[model samples]
Target: MISVEGILFAAALFCCALATAGYLISLLVRRVALAKISTWILAAGFMLLTLNLLVAAVHWTGWSSFGSRHFLSIYAWVIAGIYLGLQLKTKTRLLGAFIAPFILLFLIAAAGQGADRNLVPSQWQGGLTTLHLVLAIAGEALFVLASAAGAMLLIQNNLLKNKKPGPLGRLLPSLGDLDQINHFGLLWGFPLLTLGMIGGAVYAAFVWGGSWPADPKVVWSFAVWVFYGFLLHQRLAIGWKGSRMAVLSCLGLIVFLLSALGIRFCLATVHNFI
Candidate 1:
């Protein structure tokens, strides 16, 4: 018999898939009705995913044994939760076209059947670990939204520049709104990410002997941090905006994601807590 957590997980997966389809249909058809329906469907999916996580936590002693799989699940939950929160604040319903695909990707990743074979030592299972992962994943979720907004801005700008305002372009948020979301993401995400890095470094030094700077994952994380730092500097100091900023934001997100995903598998890293 399927457990309650398993049942909830399956339902959450189905809801996310349907929610993604609803958002995509709304984008292609430019139908306000479909967009509204998609919004509710996504909300339902988010709630179900949340419950699934909660139930799992109850069984596993509340994140004390979290591994790569739990990180992926929490990452997906944060992304979806942030998107829903942004929808309440902004007119970004159409932005779901970009956000939903990521939600689906994360959900699929979370569904992997791998159990935690390398749980951290019991002595290392408290506040710092929780704080580091939570802050880091939350910051990444914001970056994901920022990148999606940037992509929309670029698409909208291209249509305007070429005098080809297609039906899809008509549905996107205004350039100003998209830029605001990007700005919000950067303003908050950078500090959280920095703190997370600091927390991780402290935890590592406390647990292991050194800071593990030679680790490839640490190097990649620093690179990602520097890339976002440069983008923020460009935006605030040089007053970069519109297409240029959009392009950079999207590019930075790709680099951030690649460093997180690709570097983990491609290189030998001590941070592989899987």
Candidate 2:
């Protein structure tokens, strides 16, 4: 008998694989309908990934399987969710081209990271830990989605400025709409992040003795906060818009993913076990 996690992950892998194949097919065939189909397939993949996490939460929460590593899996779903959210406002399918493959890559990496029953922080057993983890994930999702939108906008803008429009250019939403989403992301994502940082710091201080910097997680989190701070300040005070703002969001995610995943896993940071 197959476990729920295996079934869900298998379903997700299949969906993402199909979506990527369809997008790649569209590239050769140049069929607009194929691109639309890819979007729906990608959404299905996202649904499967979310179900995988839900099953894991039910079965592994007691064993501490829902912490940091799970965040990477959730990140893939969150990216898909954000793309779906954008669909309500636009008819662009080009995004699925880049986004679907990116998500596929993340989930594959997530599979390698796998489940970490022992990764849950011993000190975070109470309800506050749940709050911290949940908010931190939700916040990270928004910021990363915003960053992706910014990147899309930059790609679209350059194509327009240079008077050359191709498949990628035609597939993106209007620059104006993406810019608005980017603004929404920064405006909302920053506050949630602030709350996350505060909650995490307090949690850390309680668990790791009096030393506030006991974890490399602390350093990365602080760096992310400061980077976003500069982004927010520039957006509000300097009237920055379009490509410039998108670049900021792009840079933020680079630092953010590094802090969130790269540092935690590859570098074996303090949060590696958590």
Error of model 1, residue 145, in angstroms? 0.6
> Mind giving the per-residue lDDT tens digits that candidate 1 earns over 1-274?
6778778877888888898899899988888678778888888988998998888788786444565666777888898998899999997898887998898898787777453544455677778978888899898888888889999999999888899887767788888999998888887888899999999889888777775788888888888888888888888898988888789889988887777677668887766653
Specify the highest-lDDT model's number: 1
Worst 10 residues of 2 by lDDT: 60-69
- The RMSD (Cα, Å) of candidate 2 is 2.7
Which candidate tops TM-score?
1
- Per candidate, the number of residue pairs that clash is 0, 0
Judged by lDDT against the true structure, how good is candidate 2? 0.76
TM-score, per-candidate, Cα-based: 0.93, 0.86
Candidate 1 lDDT (Cα, 0 to 1): 0.82
Cα RMSD, each candidate: 1.8, 2.7
lDDT of candidate 2 over 134-225, digit per residue (tens): 67766777787678678879988999999887875665678988888788878878888888778877877787768768567778888888
- CA-lDDT, candidates in order: 0.82, 0.76
Give lDDT: candidate 2, residue 107: 73
